[model samples]
Target: MTAADLALLDEEVTHCRACPRLVEWRERVAREKRAAFRDQTYWGRPVPGFGPADARILILGLAPAAHGANRTGRMFTGDRSGEVLYAALYRAGLATRPVSVSADDDLRLIGTRITAPVKCAPPANKPEPAERDNCAHWLRRELRDLAELKVVVTLGAFAWAAWWMALEPVYGVRPPTPRPRFGHGVVHQMPGLPAVLGSYHVSQQNTFTGRLTPAMLDDVFRQARSLAGEESRG
Candidate 1:
């Protein structure tokens, strides 16, 4: 039943046109192909969460990259940000491969699933609050479907806030009054809900600038595995 529910929810995510601005941005990016990928076809729709249905760790990010996920139809694929993330996941023994060039690649997340607060690629990589709110139901549904979800490692503050919002509406988990702010390596444990961890995003700004090192990223996943009670194979 849970598998069927998650499959259907993922299917529903691709057809969502709830936000006009997001729709325009994602579609336009798809239509206007980048020179490097001009020979390739773009996915240009709401990206869906993907991984083992019973995954215990959820890696939540802000949104899809305009050329990355918007082009590959898979979360965190075909981009540098994804390169950093997938490599780290592989080193952590959570992913089958260390690279994700396209959705059809031989990449697999072992016990972790990846998602975003906003499904669509927004203009300038920023989704308006209304667009985020409009897209919240997809997350709400995904969270409800991840029956074994135990820990969430949020890539940035947006994902951090989104998970907090999902707690009450999706899981009936009311976070303590005055919600906690996001900070890398910080873990938030609350009653009757999965633990949440914050991490700096794996964008070039963080990676190339040395703000988030490979060791730092590995530590975050190590912490996530520890929190989820999973044995480390990395």
Candidate 2:
């Protein structure tokens, strides 16, 4: 609920070694070092959510990319996925810059936060269900701490499901029977909780294949702003 509390949680997330598999993978990648980034030091630890604690919108992703966030120590940064995502956020007036290149970059999110269900980057970009479960507590605590949260923009089916799962424990209410299906532009509202909006992840698979476009992503955030009662630009 407090800024200091969120900061403490973030620090705890970075030091976590809860799942052995994830711990090994993230560190291995950091030590091996990608060819292009060999000279740069890799974070090789859990990437905590970015943005202010009082943010009204939360953008949830699947997980960090081994060569992206795992290298930069910031969610959705240093990767093609971030390129697409941040650009769209800029178009929606939610981001101060359209590119997120490094953890120290001046880029900033306006009234929004970006995080992932799994804090560590898994091998092959796929995390086991056990790993996801192990990291669920972090997400739950983040949700409970974002006191002004009004909407969640889930970037894929995994994030959509994670949002639902994390909310029940925080709100002490179960999701409605027959949970809503996930798809681009889908919106579902739960009583006394922030509205959830679905969007195709900005991964290369989606953006390169035309499954997700800038305009589509822009519209999603536009809707999010409206849902949160924030002003929107054309």
Clashing residue pairs for model 1: none
TM-score of each: 0.97, 0.98
Task: Give the Å error, residue 206, model 2.
Answer: 0.4
Candidate 1 Cα deviation (angstroms), residue 50? 1.3
Residues 1-234 of candidate 2 have per-residue lDDT tens digits of: 798999999999999999999999999999999999999999999999999998999999999999999999999999999999999889888899999999998999999999999999999989999999999999999999999999999999999999888867988989977899999999999778899999998999999999998888889988999998787433
lDDT of 1 by residue, 1-234 (tens): 377888999999999999998999899999997999998999999999988788999999989999999999999999999999999999998999999998988788988999999999998889999999999989998888888888999998989999898989987768778999899999999876899999999988999999999999999999999999887433
Report model 2's TM-score to 2 decimal places: 0.98
Worst lDDT 10-window in candidate 2? 225-234
Off by over 4 Å in 1: 232-234
lDDT of every model, 2 decimals: 0.92, 0.93
